[model samples]
Target chain A: MSIASHALWVACLGLPALAADRIEGPGLGSPVSAQSVAARNTSIYPDGRGLPEGRGSAGDGRLVYQQKCASCHGERGEGGSGGHLVGRGPLTGSDADKAVGNYWPSATTLFAFTRRAMPMDAPGSLSADDTYAVTAFLLYLNGIVGADEALDARSLPAVRMPNRDGFVWIDAVQPEKPR
Target chain B: MPPVNPSCRAIARCVQSGGAVRAFSVVLDCADTMISPDTQREHSAAVAAQEALSMERWSRSRLNADDQAPVAGGGLLDRRLFLKRGLVFSGAGALAWSSGAAGADQAALPSLRVPGRGFSNYGQPSEQEKRAIRWISANRAVPGNGVSWSPLHALEGIITPSGLHFERHHNGVPDIRIDAHRLLIHGMVERALTFSLADLARYPMRSQMLFVECGGNSNSGWNKEPLQSRAGYLHGLASCSEWAGVPLAVVLDEAGIDPAAKWLIAEGADAAAIHISIPLKKAMDDCMLALYQNGERIRPENGYPLRLIVPGWEGILSIKWLQRLEVAAEPVMARNETAKYTELLPSGKSRMFTFVMDAKSVITSPSPGDTLRSHGLYEVRGLAWSGRGRIRRVDVSADAGKTWAPAQLQEPVLPMCFTRFRIPWNWRGETAVLKSRAIDESGYVQPERDKLVAERGRNGYFHYNAIAAWQVDEDGEVTHVYR
Candidate 1:
């Protein structure tokens, strides 16, 4: 059978009218409609490519961060059960805790990761505005931006990370160069 | 009803070939003809001669510390001699049964005269084999965040039985209802697409026998002192299995990947929302959207319905319960790539996206917690593997690093899969240190513990592929040691 027709037949099996195929549907996973793609496209890129159109300040982000993120990531972002968000220590050479303020390379990644997966218990549950505000709050906690500074797609990508140039992409397949 | 016995089936087929009476007569005549005097005498004589020959071989093969014939160019015995007795290397290899030819040792045990339990739709390892289990190590504060180690030393073959495969979790395994699970392929694409588990199953599929090793495997090796736990508990983060699924390349091609897309940010559906950035080259090269593991629908902990199996890559990159693939020009630089899984090199610079595992081997049989038990003639067996390619050779050093002897690699040493290697050793009661080093197909040799430490420095905590050493004491106790 053609691939397109096969995809449709497989999807049609999920419908109720297909009485004989109902039991077999469990073995075959439920079909995903084409419309489902729009909702699932939630990842944000390093260049602020997939960020949703929204804006928020550190003041607004504080309430969202406390209500959602604070329990896992400590009250002051000092790291309790989750990762520490605010640390000025070195990123490498010594065993310094890699926190967002020092280790992260991109600020847009903060919004993308938190929006898609955050609060640890409930992921993709925060509103777009809440995600932007939380990203601003985390930046403020890290002393990268002011507490009252507003952030959106344009501003979040412009913020620089402390260890932006620390990472070096060494080829995993290559042997250690004769140092 | 009990499953049909092969012997009974054979008898039934014989009866069908001829009438029951004729079959009975044929059996009697065959037995009578075989027992005839002349034939009996000749058979007995031939048996006697064969037994004598085997007896001579038995005496020669018998364990004797002083009487071993030296191998050419080495003090150790010829490696071929180790395969003479029960070292059958087919499908899981031989069990090393130290008994008479007819298994007289087991004959002493009573047989069950009555019928036992009936068969079930599903099966489990015999209750007597309860020792094979994943040893769990979790964060006390967050029970969800933890890892369960596969009991590698207890298992026999290359394939890690699904139940005992190692598990690494950021947030505990989510009970995903397969019907609700959807995979999204978006970002730099001509057409963003969503596929259900059923849709993926309809696509063309492929199976590969490969190992998924956690990047942090052998992390204990980075410790200043050697860990004293069993082999599996220390370095069992890796497990091999036959993963069958649709190729991610086909899925991405269907979604129409943009020319500019160089990275794919794959994310899992777990509460932790664990995601990692995979290079497009690796994804298009040999990545699979895995649906079944070991010929069955994957278990919940293993990301049932769908997972990404990037052969020879770190385990985290092969995301479990994969939900989304965001094609992008650059990596996501997510917390996983930045905060964790990255290595701190001695040059004070950090190494990111170090995916492939290095060549390494460990003597699991003689590892810590396994007693030597007055070892006379023992098959020193272990596992060796390399991510670059197939294993070329494995060398065992009995006196620490003083001398080295080659071990026999089991047949079908596929790339990135576990290669079981065995060498026969005669252990007198004297104390000795044991080590095994592996060389991959690419001519890369596994470095010694000291050499690896000197190069990577103490700041390193991941990708420790140094040769592991075990110390055998005079009292027959085996312990982990850095020789």
Candidate 2:
């Protein structure tokens, strides 16, 4: 926040307002080892900034999806009580089957999400190889990827999503009105 | 068999029975004077004769007719009528003195003979009050990913009881040991640092009453028809509390920003590790790493130890059980922001990051599922709030939108907090439509359901802050309705 707003914030708390923004603290935070940072960094950016090193293809991922995801998400990502992960429904319709193919805008999200929380029953249980393979398998099922084409951290980020440019950021206080 | 004024109905029964009636009575609830303001304890023949004479006298002389007169369309009366003195119900409450049923149910105190139970280390609501609970609705396959609605209809005032606050879980709450829990702040910063729960508590903190509303709150209002449910079930996804915490600005300034950082990827420790990309600007604003809720160390369900408070923003952005903050130059396009929270319009385009819950209000008492057995005098109470600033005025409409009157707002109306509003209503056994609309200091008026849908198409499912309407039948049964 700007210094003026910061001053107002402090004043609202019934505290004396500070004329200038303080750039220093007691520095109570403790530093961590590189390994500790790596263990904690679970976020994967939109541009594939944190994709783990692993290589896999649709051919190698079919078995992984069947074993870990089929029980809830169905054998072909068609769904079995769980939300369908593969669908191409119209976004303008009420029953918009928003899934990977028609809704998800990034491919790295698949790996980032799988590595952090997937398989419902066992989150964080997938290895980098398993995550990459499962991501590729879902992508192939959605027709965004080929069967034999191997995908690693380098090539995965380059695979463009079908709805990459479909989203629009809104910061206005008003909602959209039809003409 | 048509609905009739309870008092007049009783008078008609008394006149039909030519002989001295057994016992003349009034609706017990309508009689705040205990057993029907002018009723005798004994149901003897002599007392019955005297009661019959009084009923005939009451029928001849209309009581409190001026006070019960409608100020606006329907039965709305002056908002201050409740606070004013005197004005006995007279002919207001449901004349429940059935010419059939005899004695008063609680004329004698049965609990006086039995000793009350001793107090405990922690107290709970009485067995009778246990009905006021969070109604859980989750996915059939993944029970963890669901919502539990608060019982707003069963509550009064503004502050939602901590235990009764609504909850939305992505993959269930995780059991985190405080000592082991660490908040990792990395990425674009001069120094990457970690703060334990103890470390965070030592910082200076401030308390403020603010509401956190889910983006998907009131999404059901976008349905083809009005949902027949309690007010909270439809809109209780939003809740207010007196939150105490260290400002996120303090922590961010201490870490030293890299200047290039534009976004912060906040992730929770739950099994879903549910993450969202927030703009750095909001972090520097009113955001706080909340350490306490409602003057307590927060509940296990409400992110104990630490939860981020993003004042007035969507509830999902609050990030409960918060664990990490990855500062970067761009957003991660998390599933929540891109595919879920985003609104799809009829034009085939979608709008994402529609933050800030606009002005909204709803009548809790006499809402759907509540029946008004008494007709004399009633108080219409409800909650009103806005994300922008303090609530300036809340107008209530009893005959759809035909007419409206300003409700009396509860005192100490703070910004971004729940402000209680109430108005006096004198129901005369007439069918009426009830509704309330909030106006924030920012000059934003809560839209009607039709105008809202006209602007934002049916495909737009989130951020629905439209006026809610309730229909009261002549028989006093209130039900949810669109008109």
Top-scoring candidate (lDDT): 2
DockQ, per model, reads 0.18, 0.30
Query: Once superposed on the true structure, which residue ranges of model 1 sit more than 4 Å away at CA?
Result: A1-36, A57-67, A92-94, A172-179, B1-62, B70-77, B85-111
> How does each model score on lDDT?
0.72, 0.74
Q: TM-score each candidate.
A: 0.79, 0.83
Tens digit of per-residue lDDT, candidate 1, span A18-69:
3322121112333345557556665666667668888998999999989997
Report the C-alpha lDDT of model 1 over B1-483, residue by residue, as the tens digit: 311112222323333333221111122212222223443344334322322211122123435434565442223455676546754332211223334454664655445455678989999989766556676654434555667778787776689999889888887788888897888887788777778887777777878899999988887677655655668867898999999988777778777789977888898988878888888988887788999999999988898878999888888998999998888777767777866677777665678888889998988876677665544555677899888989999998878878888888988799999999887776666787888999999999999999998888765566889999988888767778999
* Model 1 chain B lDDT-worst window of ten: B20-29
Q: Root-mean-square deviation of each candidate, in angstroms? A: 18.8, 13.6
Tens-place lDDT per residue, model 2, B1-483, is 221122332322332232111111111111112222222222122222211111122232233644455678887888877666875545422253322133354445567667888879988898756457676655445556666767787788788889988888877778888889999888888778899988988877888999888887777677666655667767888888999988887888777788988878788889888898888888887788998999998887888778988888888889989899888777787777876788777766778778778898989876876666655556788999998889999999889989998899998799999999998776677898999999999999999999998887776667888999999998777777887
TM-score of chain B of 1: 0.82
As a whole number from 0 to 100, the lDDT of residue B388 in candidate 2 is: 88
* Model 1 lDDT, full chain set: 0.72
Q: Which clashing pairs does model 1 show?
A: none
